[model samples]
Target: MKWQNSLKDYQLYLKIERGLSKNSIDNYILDVKKLIDYLDANHINISPVSISSEIVQQFIYEVAKTVNSRSQSRIISGLRSFFNYLIFEDYRADNPLELIESPKIGRKLPDTLAEEEIDQIISAVDLSKPEGERNRAMLETLYGCGLRVSELINLKLSDLFFEEGFIKVTGKGDKQRFVPIVDATKNYINIYRYQIRIHTNIQSGHEDTLFLNRRGKQLTRAMVFTIIKQLVEKIGLKKKISPHTFRHSFATHLLQNNADLRSIQLMLGHESITTTEIYVHLDRQHLKGVVEKFHPRK
Candidate 1:
């Protein structure tokens, strides 16, 4: 089959069967496209089902010169998944990348802000502007809920269950979970909603969206990143941070304060407890405290 035809089918499989998000599907498709591009550039004519491991290896060798190990590893994984899909569909007898191995890279720890640093960033918001309260509420919800940027952006008014003290978050793969909301976060959201949001001329189809831009439409992910970047600059803080930093800080702080991994896993909407265990590495003191408190030898 043609590369494009196989890619189209792979995209559908990723979306419908694997339930991957658009961003994920796009990345997977991009990996395959890169291989197709490489073949075209080298004057090699080969279809997806007919491409040999040597050609794929040559493409990877070229890729290594351009990208870092982590990114290269991701591309390798993406290509592997694509070929595996072909194998599953009976188009190929085996995955071409089955014998390939990803480069060994150390687990990169997430950057986390201290509690005081978090306070400083939040306080840097200029309350004089009409969007000030809204910004505060958005930041609060991001940190307080440990929400992914996508989840924060897609949050709806109907998701807020204030009386029940939990907000329903639709996470990766459209999986929904109820995250406990604190009084402080709830109050900030209320202030923004009742005072500021009510005055804005919300556009149709975005009426139920929890956060909106000045145009009365839903806020984009880039807008959220820009908001946090401006705040970081205003505070004169040197550490590079994004919306995800607040999430890392939330999970890190929780782990530091003796919170269990499983609970943090649930709160962070992690599909695996192993994902939450990274926070354990972030807080060595917490682990020390645990050992000292409960270890039989201690």
Candidate 2:
């Protein structure tokens, strides 16, 4: 079968059966496309079904030269998933990546801001401008609720449950979770929604969208990054940060203050407690304090 046909079928399965997002399906497709591009560039005429492990290995060898170990590992993993899909469909007998092993890479810890740093960044906003309140509210929600940038951008008006002190969040694979929202976060959001947002002429289909661009359309992920970038630069902060920094900070701060990992996991929408354990590692000093404060021996 043609490589294109195989890839098209795989994307459909990912979307329909696996329930992968468009971004995820696109990434998987890119992995296969890289192999196809390599074959075409080398003038090799073998079809996907007829391709050998050696050729795939050669492509990986070439990929290793240009990317870091982490990225190389991801590309290899993507290709492995594609081949596994082929095997599952009975189009191919085995995975080309069966014998291949990923390189040893450390789990890089996420960066976080302290309370003061977060405050300074928010304080740096020019409240004189019309967008300032929106910016402040967005940053507040980001740090307060520990939201992913995608989740923040996709937040809707109907999702707010102020009386219940919660807001609905749509996470990875479209899983919905109701995260607690404090009055402070709700007040900030209300300032934007009631004051600034009311004046703007929202675009069609974006009326429910919580955040908007100058055109009153839904905010993009890139726009969120850009907003954080400008804020970091304005505050002259040295640490590299993104919209996700607030999320990491939210988890880290909670852990340091003696909040349980399971509760933090629920707040962060992490499927596993292990994912939340990284914050525990970040606050060993706090753990030591806990032992010193409450232990009977002390």
Which window of 10 residues has the lowest lDDT sum in candidate 2? 278-287
Q: Write the per-residue lDDT of candidate 2 for residues 71-137, one digit (tens) a residue.
A: 8899999999998888999989988898888888888888989899999999998999988999999
Residue clash pairs of candidate 1: none
Candidate 2: which stretches are off by over 4 Å?
Answer: 294-298
Candidates' TM-scores? Answer: 0.97, 0.96
Best by TM-score: 1
Give the per-residue lDDT of model 1 (tens digit) for 201-277: 99999999999999999999999999999999998999989999999999999888778889999999999998888
lDDT of the structure predicted as candidate 1: 0.93
| TM-score of candidate 2 versus the correct structure, residues matched by position | 0.96
